[model samples]
Target: MAVIIKPFSLTVEDYLKQEEKAIDKSEWIQGKIIKMAGASANHNRLTLNLSRLLPLERGEQNYEIFVSDMRLWIEESQSYVYPDVMVIQGEPEFTDSQQMAVTNPCFIAEILSPSTAGFDKSQKFTLYRSIPQLQEYLLIDQKSYRVELYRKVGERQWLFTEFIGKDAIVELEIVNIQIAFSELYKRVKF
Candidate 1:
């Protein structure tokens, strides 16, 4: 007979302590620790493009842009996730004095991979909405020239917009910036 042992769940504090010393990145969701996977070449390219473009485009705007390294704390869900790209308008709010985790992000962009696409669009998006300071959520496709935006329109309401093809431009009114698909997908071969 085959034996199946359940995995042990870690407390939020335990996870944080271990994650600090750990070499790789992992996410904590409701006491379950989920290991993050490596990004593909295309995924890395897209992430780099956005991280670079967002800062340059927002001229004179007080926005801090962080790539995949920074961790985001979702208090409502008791979860910690590292978004592909995060844009904080004005000052950023950290979860603790350690400053490893941020509590506020005005805009977040996730580059989609086949393995995480479903979660990013559904459950992840749901959790992000719980953050009061989050104004815009963006999803970029690494496999194609596609981008999805969800802007907070009202209390518990979001306006969705899609940009397709190379010519499509993603206009973020909150940040007063427009990014072309050509620029976002630059050097990213599908």
Candidate 2:
């Protein structure tokens, strides 16, 4: 499918207003609004697997995990983001108009897409790190059976780890849980 490239000019407020009326998923980044591309079978599988696993595992009182659709807000950068899977802990400060967007999320996951892999790894990672409360960021590869995890270390540094194969287990330090790689790809076809 040919991507419909919309010129970047809308202010953050305008982008939010326009997004409310949009029929499909889109994200506003640095004044440029980009439409979300359709997900691949592997991407869909990974998203569904995380959505099911996180909520059941994350303690009810501490966090709420959501699939795609919920927005993540970065106030300093004046940008809004929609993550593949996000886990938010604590009482979030929300805007009356942006009740759907989350101000703070402890963990955020993004499954790679061909059209978005570069941005997700570089730009989006940089932007997500700015979130003061974000403790972990996950990037799952659709083509390869790998998951790259970044855990926050201090005010400005983060630690990285990668998991692959059925023997591997993914760790979420923020919530104190371990998820087996095999469990995540249980029903996923290679």
TM-score of each: 0.92, 0.90
What lDDT is obtained when candidate 2 is compared to the true structure?
0.80
| Error at 56, model 1, angstroms | 6.7
Predicted structure 1: lDDT: 0.86
Tens-digit per-residue lDDT, 1-190, candidate 1: 0112226789999999999899978888778777887788888898888888776346666888888889999999999988998988888899888889898898999988887888899978999999999999999988888999999999999999998899999998768878998888889887
Q: RMSD, each candidate, Å?
A: 4.2, 2.3
lDDT of 2 at 26: 77
Task: Name the Cα RMSD for model 1.
Answer: 4.2
Question: What does candidate 2's lDDT look like per residue over 11-74, in tens digits?
Answer: 8889888887988877887777777767777888999988777744445566677788888878
Looking at candidate 2, the ten consecutive residues that score lowest on lDDT are: 1-10
Candidate 2, which segments miss by more than 4 Å at Cα? 1-5, 56-61
Query: Candidate 1, after superposition: displacement of residue 51 in Å?
Result: 1.2
Candidate with top TM-score is: 1
- Backbone clashes, each candidate: 0, 0
User: How far out, in Å, is residue 131 in model 1?
Assistant: 0.6
Residue 135 local lDDT, model 1: 94
